[model samples]
Target: DQQVKQNSPSLSVQEGRISILNCDYTNSMFDYFLWYKKYPAEGPTFLISISSIKDKNEDGRFTVFLNKSAKHLSLHIVPSQPGDSAVYFCAASHGGYQKVTFGTGTKLQVIP
Candidate 1:
């Protein structure tokens, strides 16, 4: 069984709008969650992260929220721009372990 899941395969948003990506996990042991954005022909780059202890974390236009009780998480991008178009992966890890599980990924298209 897949521990991490991204229900939506893709999302579209107009420029300067908001983009929301959702994720779910079956593993309750996960205490750390992260979001990664990947561009074509390049590796995924870390975007934002949240520990189980925190409900939300934000940086600039990017924000991540985690609901430990529900085993769900989401990534929000405000004022989405054309450059923000990419495949976003939701990842989770436990404690100090470096091993992480990643979701299938959601492709976001920011149309201008």
Candidate 2:
């Protein structure tokens, strides 16, 4: 079972266009959510996160929204740039557990 699912393996968008990535979770115990952006061979950099208590979080050109009731989440990037081409991973954790489960990741390509 894919406890965490990122259905899309990749996405391509034109420069300055909007990019949207989707994720889903099956575990009901997850209470913390995080989105990490990664470049090839580099560590993932924290983008944005929202606890189960909140519905959304935004920073700079990135925004993440979570819906606890629906067990779904999404990431949106505005005015996408070529530099934004990278892999995005969705992760979740059960508050009491130290381990976090991650999605397979989605690769976003921004064409200039």
Number of the top lDDT candidate: 1
Pick out the ten consecutive residues of candidate 1 with the lowest summed lDDT. Answer: 92-101
Pairs with steric clashes in candidate 2: none
On residues 42-99, what C-alpha lDDT tens digit does candidate 1 reach at each position? 9989999999999999999999988888899999999999999999999999994679
Which whole-number lDDT from 0 to 100 does residue 25 have in model 2?
Answer: 99
Whole-model Cα lDDT of every candidate shown, in order: 0.94, 0.93
Query: Mind giving the per-residue lDDT tens digits that candidate 2 earns over 6-35?
Result: 999999999999999999999999999899
Q: What residue runs in model 1 are displaced by over 4 Å at the alpha carbon?
A: none
On a 0 to 1 TM-score scale, where does candidate 2 land against the true structure? 0.94
> Number of clashing residue pairs in every model?
0, 0
